[model samples]
Target chain A: MPILSVKDLQVTFDVRSAGSWPWTPPRKLHAVGGLSFDLEPGQTVGLVGESGSGKSTVARALVGTVPASGGQILFEGQDLAAMSPQERRRHRKDVQMVFQDPLAALNPRMTVGDIVAEPLVTHHPETSRAEVKKRVGDIMERVGLLPNLVNRYPHEFSGGQCQRIGIARALVMKPKLLICDEPVSALDVSVQAQVVNLLRDLQRDMGLSMIFIAHDLSVVKHISDRIVVMYLGRIMESGPAREVTLRPRHPYTQALISSVPIPDPVLEKARPRPILEGELPSPLSPPSGCVFRTRCPKAKPDCAEPKDRIQREGEVQVACPYQEVKDALAV
Target chain B: MKLASGDAKLLDETAQLASIRGRSLWADARGRFLRNRAALLGLIVLVLVAIFALFGGYFAKYEPDYVDFSLMGANAYRGVPSFESGHYFGVDFDGRDLFARTVQGTGISMLVGVVGALVAVVVGTLYGATAGYIGGRVDNIMMRTVDILMSIPFMFVLILMLVIFGRSMFMLFLGIGLISWLDMSRIARGQTLSIKNKEFVEAAVATGVRPFTIILRHVVPNLLGIVIVYSTLLVPQMIIFESFISYLGLGIQEPQTSLGALINQGAEQMNNGTLWMLAFPLFFFLVTLFAFFFVGDGLRDALDPKDR
Candidate 1:
């Protein structure tokens, strides 16, 4: 059974009018509409999407950071939406998050020890100060940070080291689920690989389930067992990482895959880069039926009509109506 | 079980961390502050002034308010400070010890400045932190109230408070503190608004750390640099305010003297050419204000993360 299951999770934000008219009704912006996913224990699910695709909202909603407007979030068979304040707090201990921009994520005023010890001190009040100190030191070392630097402030560390500190803070709680929201996007390319590897190692060692949200498909591909592609608050395609990257059915996913640079110059030249047309439409007024229909090359009149069905082709599930026909024609 | 295995490795690594000397943020800030020459000088002067206020009266042999009729019989009631007469500083028009009264005034002025600034810090910190942390509609309402309060003339509000409460020390302190807190609260609120959104606060919330804890530990501590730097600036302003009010006869009435009241008295006697009367009190007040300014500037530099 999946350790965490989200069913039709919806999140909407009310954006007030920028104009002076107070009587104007506030518009409801659908950030994430009817998003669903399941995370098996010790599994890494990569939620890949461009900015404003509501991928981060999904991660935040699961952690209860951003409140869900509708649908159910089931963790260990219990619905998070139904949980009381006390129960939700208890649930929070099992799920922890590592944020993007490591330096911004940490308190500049705090020492490394205090930052890592916060989770333990908050959830496990019974733990002694000495034990916390000892544990923090251990976690720091595990994350490749020098334990001796416990007293140093966040500004003293480099970007990569700061990220390691962020990871140590997240892992100290012994969380079953770790939501990494673009954990390496702010970091340099060399540091990105280091942090990603550290996360992978920690997940293996701690049996942690992860939701790695990122815009770069290549970055998530290495860490994720499964990949779910999102576009303007809706899922475009989802399947095992290998299958989705190799045999992308959705035209949107195919375009996204082609956008990633291939290292080999010869192969890069041979690759058919479907340069997507038109900018992403605002989430405030998304296209009817298929949200991506406006930019979708294969979008037809039927694609504009309301459809609730999600068709499965092989291992991947695609929202497009003519996905199978297109795949058969390609063969 | 897997977690325990990882923790076991952590225990072994603990030995390596013991050699590192942990430097607190305060200790680091202090180290930087000490290196600043002007700040160090200001600190020394402040310490000397505090000692002088506490015990300088004891240095003078005569009582602060003792009137000497014998001194009036002579060609001059106010005598130049002479060791033979045991008068360290010349007698005032009332034949009171100028040195002792000056010492007494130091205590009163310092008390008002320190206490008033402290009150401002407390109220401002709480008000601004709450406004910034809560945010949204609550923040809007709270900030609007601040704006309304800010729009009112400070002196008008102060005089009204004094008129209602009477010109007691408590009322004087409250009036100064109330006015000073407006700026402090605004600075704190702006800082809290920025810090409240930082990922550390979010991480604290994610870890189930309560709102109060987040404010106290995360929000307040980060604001200490600006708060402390602003506090130094506030002390000098408070002293000036006390002086202005006392000069107006609305503060520090007879018997108990503030530097402001002393300066007011000295200014009246300036026509008589008793330069020392005006010279000493005005000099001390100016010196104290400058000390605060120097220290405040130094602290601003010291506490700035950019400087480090």
Candidate 2:
């Protein structure tokens, strides 16, 4: 069974005014709109796209940090949207997040031990102090922290160490589903591989499930089982990681993949790489019909008309007027 | 061999636990604080002032305002120093010891300064923290109120308070504390706004840490260094206000000497050509005020995280 599933998740942020000036109205921006996805036990699903993809917004809403405007979040066949505060607090013990910025994410004043032990102490307050200390030490060791160094403050540690502190903080509970929101985005290039490899080993060893959010497709392809492509508060494409990386159908995904520098000179010179034509349309008032239609080279007159979403390639789906245009072109 | 292995493990565990309590927080703060030369000097001077206050009463045989006729004219035309051997600072016009009363005035001035500043810091922290953290219209309203209050002349307000409360310590506290606390509130509000949304605070939220505890534990610790620096800086300001009220005779009454009130008393000695009366008390107040200023500046420079 899927460990967690989200159906038509919508979150809209009311930025500023509550009332209307005749032309302006309220500046209600749609940060995430009608997005849906799922994760099974012990699986890592990578949500990949460029910046402002609403990828992080979806992750935050799943962890219940951001309030949902509409839709259901099912965790272990239970509706998270309907859960009471007490039930939600209990549910959160099994799912947690490690945000992108390490120094800002971890409290600067707290010792590494306290930051790691906080979740354990909070959720399982009944645990004895001795056990809590033991658990903190064990997790610190598991995350490659020197046991003697646990009392050091966050500022004393480097960026990568701070991220390790963040990971230890999230992993101490041995949570079933971890939300890694660009965990390596803020780290040094050399340290990125170490942190990524550590997470991969921990997931495999602990049978952990995660929804890894990142703009780095290459990094996502390394560890993710499946990939979900997001574009301007909506999912544009999702499929098996290798298939999506090798042969992307969506124009945005194609631009993103080709931009990933090819090491081989022959293929790098040969492929007809499409450079992105324009800036991503603003999420606040996205283009009607298919949101990506304005940016798609294959846009048709019918693409200007809303082509209600269509299913393609087994369970994969695309909303485009040119679905049959590609067919008619005999490619 | 198995028993020996268990004993080694137990020893290692005990050492690990012992390391956690290697130093108390008090000891750490104190050690860091003492390394700062200015804080050390400020602490020493403050302690010495307190010591003088406690013991000055025991060594005094005469009242601070004692009037004696026999020695009154003795110094009038002596053409030499008068023979009052025990008065370290020579006598005043009425043959009162300038030394003994100056010593007495330190304690009273301190009592006023500390009590007044405490009221200021407490009121300011609460008011500012509430305004900044609650934010929006509430912050706007409260800050406007602060602006209105800041514009009114503080001395006029002090005199008004004096007129209402009749020169009591309560009135002195109310007069100075109510005015000076505005600065504290502003500092606290700005600092609180920056820190109240940090991850630890969010972590506290996620863990079901109550709102009040979050403010007290998380918010307050981050503000402690700035608060301490401001508190020291405020002492001299409070002393100056107390001095002003007392100098104007709107502070502590007769026989209850403040440095301010005594400065007024010493001015009488100056009017009668007794320079010793004015010199001793003025010198004492000057030394204390300068010391407080130096300490305040040193603390501001030293405790600043930016300086590091």
Candidate 3:
């Protein structure tokens, strides 16, 4: 059985208007609209999407940071959505998250020692301070932060160091699953590589399951075992990483993969760019049938059929009905 | 190549650490603050004033309220500034020692100011933090109530309370503190609004830290810089407000004299050529205000995170 399974998860935000009128009804914005996926133990799943795609929302919901509007998030066959606050707190020991902006994610007032040990203090209160210190020092050293800098504040560290601190904080809890929400997006390109490499090393060493969310397909490609492509608030394509990136079945996924620049100039020039067109429609009123249909080059009249159904061809899941036909035509 | 560079980087980091030393945020803030002459001067003056308020009575030759009829004799007691015998700052109309009274009055003024400001700090911080953290509809309602309180003519209400309650120590503290918190709460609320959404607070929540603990530990600790600066400024204002009420004969009455009451008495006796009576009290009052202003200004510079 999968270690984690999100079944038809939904997250809706209420956009309340400012008015003097007392009877104004709040407008509902469906940020995450009925998305589902699964994570196997010790495997990394990259959730690829752009801003407002509800990729981050999914990460937030799974980590128990954001409340789900509706759905069942089963961790070892137990429903996360139905758990009480105390039960949810106990569940957090098995799961952890590393947020995007490293500096912003750390308390400026706290020392490196305090920031990393905070989770242990919160979740495992009976653990002695000396034990916490030893663990925190070990984890910090593991993440390439000198244990001597434990007394230093977050502002004293560089961006890369801060991210390492963030990583160390997540890993110190010894969680089974680590959800990194665009962990490298806010970093410099050179720094991004180091952090990604560190993550890959930790995941390998720890045998940890991970859900890495990022808009950069290339960044996620190196670390993720499988890829789940999202457009707006729904998954467009999902399968093994190489297959999804190399032989993308969905038009949106193909466009996204084609956009990643190949380092070899000759091949990069030779390959045709599957450039997508049009703005992503507002999630308030997404395009009928397919969320990606508005920007999809292969969008047909059948694409407006009100509900696009996911069809599995072997291992890969494609949301479009004519995906097989399209795949054949492309070949 | 990676291993060589990694070793070189480690050496570079060690060198950097050697140069930097271990400087704490508080130490850095103090260093920056000391560079500001005005703030430093204010700090010095404020410290001296606090000492005087605390230990000024030890130097008093006579009780502040003691009336020496023998010294009054024929001049109706008002005496010019002299260092003869025990009359340090001359004498008042009732033969009370001006220097002793001025020194002792610091106690009441300091008490009123410090206590009033403390009350404001406690109330404002709690109200604002709760409102800002538990936002949405709760925020709207709490802030609206604050707005209503702010809109009212606060001085009129203060005066009414003084009139009804008759200037007891409790009323003086309550009247000033209650009105003063209006501004403090607004400042605190604004700070909390900006801080509550910071990624660290989100990180705290993600780490499964309880909401109350997050607010108390993370949110409130970060707010200390602003709160300390604001509270220091409030003390002087509360002192001034107390003096103003007392000046109007509704504050510290009779045997319980404040700097304001002393100044009022001095102002009345100025025409009689007993200028020493007025000068000493006015001097003390002005010095106290200046000390507080300087200290408050210094604190603002010192506690500012931007300085670091």
Candidate 4:
């Protein structure tokens, strides 16, 4: 069974209308509208999207940071939405999240050891202090931090080191599933590779399932077993990572793959790229039918009509009907 | 055994590295505070003033209320800070020992300042943190209430409380404390609004920490630096407020005596040329207030995270 199965998950926020009276009703912003995905044990799924694509919202919903307004979040065959408060707390230990801003994710007032040990202490109150220390130390070492530096504060460390500390804190609980929301996007280009490699190594060693959320497709492709492309709160394409990057079926996915610059200057200049036009439509009034239709290069009149079914082309689940699997690398 | 030796050497090296690089936020702040010469002087003055308030009474030859009829007569000029008879600060118009009265005034003023600030910190922090953390309508209502309270004339309400409850220390503390927290609550709420949205608080929530625990552990500790700086500043404000009320004869009552009341009495007899009474108490009061301001300024600089 999949470790986590999120079926038709939705998250909506109530925002006050601009220039409205205090008593005026609020508008509904559908941040994550009907997102569904499954994570098998030990497999990593990369959730790639633009800035406002609701990738972070999905990660937060899974970790229970933000409440899911609708649908079921099934973890180990148990629906998390239906669970009691006590049961939800019990399930919290199994799913942990690493946030985007590393330094901001750590309590400035707390020592590194205390920050990492917090999950263990909260979930297993019966565990002794010594045991908590040992576990925190082990996790710190596993995340490539010196075990003796646990007494240090978050500000004392560099951004890359802080990210490792954040990772250690998330993994200290021995959680089955970890959600990383744009984990390395905030780091320097040189340091980003180190963190990505560390995460991949940790996942291999622990047999951990992960949902890696990022706007950068190259980084996501490096670590994800499968890739789910989202735009304006809906998934446009999802398939095996290699296939999704190379043989992108949806126009939106094709645009995204084209935007990632190749290392070789010659190939990068020669590649034919279709740049997406215009800003993302506000989630408060997202485009009808496929949310990506407004930005899709292959947008048709039919794209505006509501289509509930996601068509399957082999292992790929694509929302767009018009786009064929053209050779993405063809010069 | 060889592996154990290697591990021990590694541990030693890490310890040395830690000493060089692992200064905690508090330790760093402490170093900054120590480096500040004015703050050190302020601290010393505050400590000395506190010591005098606690033990200066023991050195006085006469009680605070003792009436020396000899000094009240034609020999009143003898009350001018004579080395003999142990009247080091001379005498008040009533022939009471100025030294003893000043000591008593210091104690009461400091008490009022500390107790009042304590109440403000506790009540304001909890009220503000709850309002800010819960947010939305609750935050709106709570903060508006504070705004409404702040709009009212603070001294008018304090005087009304004094009139109704009759001048007692408890009522004075309650009056000052209740009003003072309005500003503190506003500060705490503003801080909480910013802190609640920080990723660490969310991380705590994601780690299965209860909301209240997150407030207490994560939110409150982070607030300590600002709260402490504000509280230090609050102490002098409380002291000044109490002194003003006492000057108006609505605080501390006679015989009990605060610095303000003593200063009021001294001002009344200033025409008699018994300036020692006013000089002695005013000196202590001014010193104490300046000391508190210096310390507060130093703490603000030391604890400011932006500086780090």
Candidate 5:
């Protein structure tokens, strides 16, 4: 069975109108509208999207940081939305999250050892202090941090080192599933590779399932087993990582892939990439029908009609209806 | 089990690195505070004033309330500072030794300031953190209540409290504490509003740390720098308020005088040329206030995380 199966998950926020009276009605912001995905044990799913495409919201919903407004989140065949608060707390140990800003994710006042040992102490109060220390030390070493530096504060460390500390803290619980919310977005390029490689190594060693959320497609494609492309809170395309990046079916996915610059200067100049026009539509008032239609180059009059279904094409699930037309046009 | 020479050297170096001590946030702030000359001088003066308050009474020639009938009326000129007579600060209009009165007033003023500020910090931090963290309708209601309370004239409330509860040291602390916490709560709430959304707070929630624990462990500790700075500044304000109350004759009664009460009496007798009474208490009070302000300013610069 899949470790986590989210079916039609929806998250909405009530935002007050600017400069409006308190009595005025609040607008509904559909941050993650009907997102569904499954994570098998030890499988890594890369959730790629632009800013405000609800990528982080999906991670937040899974970790129970933000409440899911609708749908079922089945973890080990148990409905997370149906669980009591105590049960939810119990489940938190099995699922952990790594944040985007490394330093900001760590408590400035806490020692590195205390930060890493927090989850273990919180969940298993019966565990001995020696055991907690051993676990924290082991996780710190596993995350490429020196165990001797446990007394240091977050600010004393570099961004890369802080990210390592964050990773250690998350993995200290030995969680079955890890959600990384743009973990390396704030690091230098060299440090980004180190952290990503470290995460991949840790996953291989522990047989951990992960949901890696980022706006950088190249990084996502490098570390993910499968990739899910999202735009304006809806999945535009999802398939095997290699297939989704190489043979993108949806126009939106094709545009996203084309936007990635090749390393070789010659190939980078030769590639014809279509720059996406217009700003991302506000989540408070998202475009009708396929949310990507307003930005899609292959947009048709029918694309405006609301369609709640996603079509399957072999290994890929795509929201665009004109996949064949786009394919023919590409040829 | 013998290792290569290079590997052994590497291991030795690692041990040396491990043994190097780390500086905690408090340690770093203390270092910064020591480097600030103004703050260091202020702390030194404050300590001296505190020592005077605690031990100066023992050295006084007469008790604080001792009435000198010989120095009363026409013979009051003999009350001036004289090495032989041992009345270093002369006598007050009530025939009390000015030196003893100043020492006693210092102790009372310091106690009120510190105690009142402690009450404000504890009550304000908790109230504001709760409202800010819980947010939504609860925050609105809680903050609105603060606003309503803030609108009422605090001095009037203090006077009303003293009248209803009858004047006592504890009642004075309560009155000053109750009114002082309003501003503290507002500052705390504003800080918490920004702090609650910080990623560390979310990380704590994701770890399933209980809400109360999150507040105590994550929220409150992060607030320490600001709270400490604010509390130091608050101490002087508390002293001033207590002194004002005493000046109005509603505080400290007759036998037990405060700096404000002493100053009021000293001012009344200033035209009569008994200037030592006024000079002695005023000097102590002003020095104490300046010391607290300097310390508070130093703490703000020292504890500011951005400075690092």
Candidate 6:
């Protein structure tokens, strides 16, 4: 059974009253539009897209960080939208989020032990203070942090340790699923790999499921069981991470994979130059048919109508009008 | 079995967080704040001022309220009002001990200032936090109320309160406190609004912590610097306000005197051309204000996150 399911999710923000410089009338920016996905137990699903793809919004909405405009988020068996404020609080323990920025994620005034232990203290108010301190120390050790450093502030820790702190914060809840929003995007490349490996190890050991969101397809390809590609608030393609990375179906996906710089000089020079047509259109009023059509190299007349959803079996889903080409590319 | 697994997992998680606690923003701010000599000295002066208010008048030899018609306008107290005679500050119009009264009055001025500042902090924090956190209609309403209060003649409001309740120290403090908190609320609201949307706050919410706890724990703690700087800077201003009211003859009226009332009384005896009568208390008041300002400005500099 899928551990979590999100169906037809939509998030809209009213950007009314034109901006000061060249003000425009109130237009709604549809952030997350009709997105659906299911995460299996002990699986990592990478939600990949650029800045305005609404990947972060989906992550936030799943954890109830931001309220969903219209959607049903089912975790285990319960629907989050139907839960009361109090009920949501209880459910929050099952799904925790590891934020993007490590430095700003923590409470600046709190001790490292206190920041990690805060969730337990809040949810389990009956626990004794001494027990709380001990539990905090234990979690620190599990994250490979020395117990002696429990009292140290976040500033004393390096970027990698800070991400570890963030990860520990999520893990301390003993959650079934973790939502990591670009967790290692800020770290150096080498440190990013280390953190990614640590996360994979922790996920394996703890049996923790995750919804990893990031713009870097290369990193996600390594860690994710499945990858979902998004553009302008709509899913462009999705399937096994290996399948999507190795044989990209959509033109957009091919462009993205081709953009990754090859370390080998010969391969780098010989790689196909799949140039993107234009800058990704504003997600606010994205082009009609397929949201990626404006940039799709093989966009047909039918591609503008988004209702013409394209699908090919035994491979990732695609929304291009040139389904045959995409299917050919997949093989 | 489930419990043990979850517990073990929790243990691992908690340990990681323990390493985080030793390096937070508040600890750094507190360390930097403690090193500020001006704030520390201001704190010392504020405490000493409180002590003087509590047990200071006991040093006087006789009742300061004694009504001796024979000594009316004597320009001195207990003994004749004379320079170099150790009745140092001389006397008031009623020949009361000016030095004793001034010392005794320090308590009232400090009390009024503190009470006023406290009211301001409470009201201002609530107003500012509410206005800042919840934008749109509610924020607009609260801020507009503040604006209306600001536009009105504050002195008129004080005068109205005093006219209705008279010059009792309680009413005076209450009235002054009510007026002073408006600025604090505005400052607090502005700060709360800015910090409300910060990433840390969103992180707190994402963790499933209640809203109120977030406001108190995260939001308020960040505002400590603003509160401290504003409160310290406010003392001298509050003292001056009380003094000005006293100077206007509407504050801390008779036996229960204030620095302002005392200064006014000293000014009355200035017709005798004796400088010591007015100079001493006025100088004390000025120096106290100066110290508070130095401390307040220093604390502001040290606690400022932007400081290089």
Clashes of each: 1, 0, 0, 0, 0, 38
- lDDT sort, best first: 4, 5, 1, 3, 6, 2
From the highest TM-score down, the ranking of the candidates is: 5, 4, 3, 1, 6, 2
Candidate 3's TM-score reads 0.92
lDDT of 4 by residue, B180-264 (tens): 7888888888899899999999998888898888889998888878888998899989999999999999999778899999898
Sort by DockQ, best first: what order? Answer: 5, 4, 1, 3, 6, 2
Model 5 ranges off by over 4 Å: A325-331, B1-12
lDDT of 5 by residue, B1-308 (tens): 35688899998898888754567888899999999999999999999999999999998998999998888884347888776776778888877888899999999999999988898899898888888888999999999999999898989988888899898887887788777788888888888999999999999999999998998999988887898999999999999999999999787877998998899888877888888878899999999999999999999999997887
Error (Å) of candidate 6 at residue A315 is 5.0
User: Residue A195 lDDT in model 2?
Assistant: 89
* Model 1 misplaced regions, further than 4 Å: A19-24, A84-86, A324-331, B1-17, B22-32, B72-77, B151-157, B160-165, B305-308
lDDT of 1 by residue, A87-155 (tens): 798888888999998998898878888898989998889999899999998999999987889888887
Clashing pairs in 2: none
Give every collision pair in model 1: A138-B10
User: Which candidate leads the pack in DockQ?
Assistant: 5
The sequence of per-residue lDDT tens digits that candidate 6 reaches over residues B1-308 is: 99999999999987766444343565566677678877777768766766665666665554556544665654443445555554545666676666677786776777777777888887788668767776778888888898998899988789778878887787787778778889898888788887877767877787889977887888887786798789878878899999998888998878878888888877877767555667767876876787778778877877787962
Per-residue lDDT of candidate 2, residues B192-294 (tens digit)? 8998777666555555445565666667777766887798778877887788788888898766778887788778656566677777778777777777776
For all the models shown, what interface RMSD does each have?
1.9, 4.0, 3.0, 2.0, 1.2, 4.0
lDDT of model 1 at residue B138? 89
RMSD for each of the candidates? 4.6, 4.7, 3.9, 2.2, 2.1, 5.6
Across all candidates, what is each one's fraction of true contacts kept? 0.74, 0.19, 0.54, 0.81, 0.69, 0.68
User: Candidate 5: which pairs clash?
Assistant: none
lDDT (Cα atoms) of all candidates against the true structure: 0.86, 0.76, 0.84, 0.89, 0.89, 0.79
- Evaluate model 3 with DockQ and give the value: 0.48
- Which lDDT tens digits does candidate 6 get at residues A1-331? 8999888888877676544443455577888888888899999999998787899888888888777888788899789977887889888888888888888887776777778888888889899988887887777777777766768777788888988888888888789999999999989999899889988998999999999999999999999999999888788888899888887877778878877777788877875677786687876677887788777777778776658586855756876646443322222
lDDT of 2 by residue, A26-115 (tens): 577898888888888999899987888798888778887667888889999999877876678777778888878888877655677777
**Model 1 compared with the native: what TM-score?**
0.92
lDDT of 3 by residue, B1-308 (tens): 99999999999988777433345666677787798788788778777877886788777788888998876743334355566657688888778887788877777888888888888888888788878887888989999999999999877888888798776878877788778787887888889999988878877777788888988889888887788889888888888888888888888878878888888888887777777777877777777778777777877877776666
